[model samples]
Target: MTFRIAILGASGYTGAELVRLIATHPQMEIAALSADRKAGMEMAAVFPFLRHLDLPKLVKIDEVDFSRIDLCFCALPHATSQEVIAKLPRDLKIVDLSADFRLRDPAEYQKWYGQPHAAVELQKEAVYGLTEFYRDEIRKGRLIAGTGCNAATGQYALRPLIAAGVIDLDDIVIDLKAGVSGAGRSLKENLLHAELSGGTHSYSAGGKHRHLGEFDQEFSKLAGREVRVQFTPHLLPMNRGILATVYVKGDPAAVHRALEAAYAQETFLQVLPFGALPSTRDVAGSNYCHIGVTGDRIPGRAVVIAVLDNLTKGSSGQALQNANLTLGIEETTGLMLAPLFP
Candidate 1:
């Protein structure tokens, strides 16, 4: 049975990506699309690349008949998605691409997002949507919350190592560089071409990033204790991708073995041969994440780098991956597009 789906916030980068991937998806159909600000406009006019697909005109969320949608991709902004999704029919499956439901604890959500969760009951039921690690839970969940793009990158490098006890628990350090699109489609002074070009600066430095909460939650759960890693994100001038270089105290060979074993059967995640690292350009525009591991110059330590398109694998693609599981569809359908290289 083909599933009927809706893209709730169709004008954003993540929403456009969902349309691109789902347009050709064999088991899903786009039944409704909403762009509150761009209601009544053709999706093609808002995103020219999507012009070729035959899709519904944009509508406001309230105007759509959600009862007909088998699944919905909530690509709305952080706090906004929570309010909108809370009122959605409970039986409708949802994959939320926002910060609202990522953190499981209600208190932590408020601490990081500066507001109480509007729908605590739904928040309690939401599954963390890291497809490779949480596939079992996702397959049975009604609500799935996508991870932070930065958090996803960091976890890709560290989660397996932590689970296997291959890395020193206290010394983990994550330095991430993300392209401008990871900041979203919002307008900001710093994202302007003249300002962002030729220079990169760290924002939310000194462990101030909200994604760290995710790192702490996931890592601590793995090690069965509190684990905090230093994470600082830099905004690069490019349009899409994330490169997270992680430093850990572990045997390099063990690091490679651990990641390889964890992802051997996974379709979207690729572990590069040892000593050969991946570039953001290698994964741009695709759902694939390329990870490489090597011994650091310092003995007893290893450096692992992971690359992915922050907009795709890091956000919307991950969203769809979880949606596939929730709806009992193949995980990699319409997600097989190769990375673009120059």
Candidate 2:
């Protein structure tokens, strides 16, 4: 069966990506596209790269007939996503690519997002959308919340180590370098070519990044205790990818072993040979996350480097993965495309 799909926030980066992937999906069809500000415009006008495919014109959220959509991918922004999703048909399957339903605790959601969750019940019911870790839950979930690109990168590096008790819980550090696309397509003076093209800088540092909340929540849950990691995100001059260099107190070989074993069966996650590393360019525009491990100069310390295209594996691609599971389709459908390489 061709599952009918609706993509809200269709004018944005993630939304456009979903359209690109689903355009070739054998089991999914784009039934509707919504872009409140860009309503009535052709998606081809918004993203010329997609002009080759015929897609529905962009409409407003209220204009979509959710009753006909088998699954909806909510690529809208933070608070707005929850507000829109709250009014969506509760029976409709949803894969939210925003920060709205990621945190289960409404209090934590407020603490990180600076507002009480408008859809607390739905938040409680949404499954975390890390396909590798939450496959079973996603397969049965009505709503699946996609992870922050930064958070997903760090987790891909460290989750297995933590689960295997091979890493130091108290002294973890995630130094991430991401392209401007991860900030979304919104116009920012800092993101302009003149301002960002020649340099690199850190935005949310000193535990101020919102994804830290996700790291704290997920890591703590795995370790059965409070696990806080120092996370600093830097914006690179490039366009699309995230490279997270995670430092942990552990044996490099053991950390490598744990990750290899955990991801051995995962289709999109690749752990490289020991002492090797991954580059963002290797995984650009693809749904694959390449991770590498090596020991630091300090004997007990290990460095885990993970990379993926923030727009693909990080957001839109991850959203599609969850949607497939929720719809009882193959988890990797339309997502096994090879990474773009120069």
Candidate 3:
């Protein structure tokens, strides 16, 4: 049976991406599209790349008939996401791509987002949307919180090592470089072509990046103790991917093997040969994550490099993956497209 889907915040990048993917999905149909500011406008006007497909006109959230939608993908911004989702049909299946429900603890939400979560109860009920790690929970979940692109990339590199106890837990570092698209489509003076075209710089440094909260929460939960990782995110001049270079104290061979074994059966995760590395361009515009491992000159040290399209595997693609599970469909449906390469 084809599931009817609604995409809120349809005018944004992630929302447009959802349209692109779902347009080809045989088991899902875009029943409604909502874009508060651009209500009544055609999605083709906002994203001409999608002009080939016929999509519903964009409307406001309240204008949508949630009762008719089988599943809804919430792509609205954080603070607003909770307010909107709180009023959505509680029984409706939701795959939220915002930061609103990622953190289970309201205290941690407030600490990182600088505000109290408006939907505390839903926050607690929303399952983490790391597809491979939480597949079972997601299938049974009513709401799934999509993880941060950076957080997801880092976890793809380190989660297996952490679980296998092959890496030094206390000495982990994630140095990530992300394409500008990860910042969202909102206009910022710094994101202008004149300002960012030929340069790059780290924005959230010194433990100031909000996604660290996810790292702390998830890693700590995995280790059954407090696991704080040193994470720094850099904004690159490019437009569509994230490459996380994770440093860990472990045997490189063992780290590679752990990741290989963990992701051996995972459709989207590809662990490369030892000493091999992945490039963002290799996974651009695709729902795949390519990871590589190499040993450092120093003994007991390893470097794990993980790459993915921030817009695809990092966000929209990940959202769709969870939606499939929630609807009891094959997890890889409409998501096995090969990455774009120059």
Candidate 4:
């Protein structure tokens, strides 16, 4: 019951991550690997770190023969993935790591993304790929849209609380700090070693961040009302994790209990002891999210902090987890690697 996979944008961090994990999969193999600019080049040329493994040479997406791919991980840029995936085989199973199909509403998609979906027909068929909550749906979906790394971290820490009626929806606030790799392998003046290595600053503040759309959509659905949370994300000087600290009005004890109860059975999600907070270093380079809960002096308020490697658990790890489910394979397959510690 081996599943053959193709990575449509295999040169980026997330794409390479999928390759790294899938290489060790007992039941999955790389059937195709695409990177337009890196086409005809060995993966080692693009990412020297990944040179150890013997993998298919990178090819252009247009050259991929879908007939040979059982599943495709669409790691292409947003807006771009929509058109690429639309042109793909209608029957090919897909896990998109772009914002293209994450929002079910085309209107919402257009509003935040500033363009109409290129594949509204297929968008309607894509399921949100949040591993813990959407496991059942993912198992049956022909196409699954992976969530934003930041969105995934926040949701993991709070969705269960919202579902269990244990938090104040209107009072929620989220502040996230993420490593530069989450921005992708592209070169940006701001991301250069000179500028980004010495300091951290917030961008997309005052509710300007696009991922808030996903948080709003998911939280509102679970709470049965329109809910908005003030979210701000900052870029850190380092290179591989996301830490989201969420504050909400709720009994801290209940917050802790709710999260514990929700994730008690999950192998990749870890809820820490009460009053403890998690650090990005703790879960770096692993498909594990360490969440901590604390009680506030106000008694009815609490703070929750979550951490995970943005490129791993936040993206590729989640993709691999959903792929495992979709292929009817063990959900934890090829994803049991321990976190890379300091």
**Which candidate ranks first by lDDT, i.e. highest?**
3
What TM-scores do the predictions have? 0.98, 0.99, 0.99, 0.98
- Which runs in model 2 stand beyond 4 Å of their true positions? none
The sequence of per-residue lDDT tens digits that candidate 4 reaches over residues 235-276 is 999989999999999999999999999999999999999998
Off by over 4 Å in 4: none
Clashing pairs in 4: none
Q: Model 2 TM-score? A: 0.99
lDDT score, candidate 2, position 83: 88
What's the lDDT for all of these models?
0.92, 0.93, 0.94, 0.92
lDDT, model 4, position 320: 92
How many backbone collisions does model 1 have?
A: 0
TM-score of 3: 0.99
RMSD of 1: 0.9
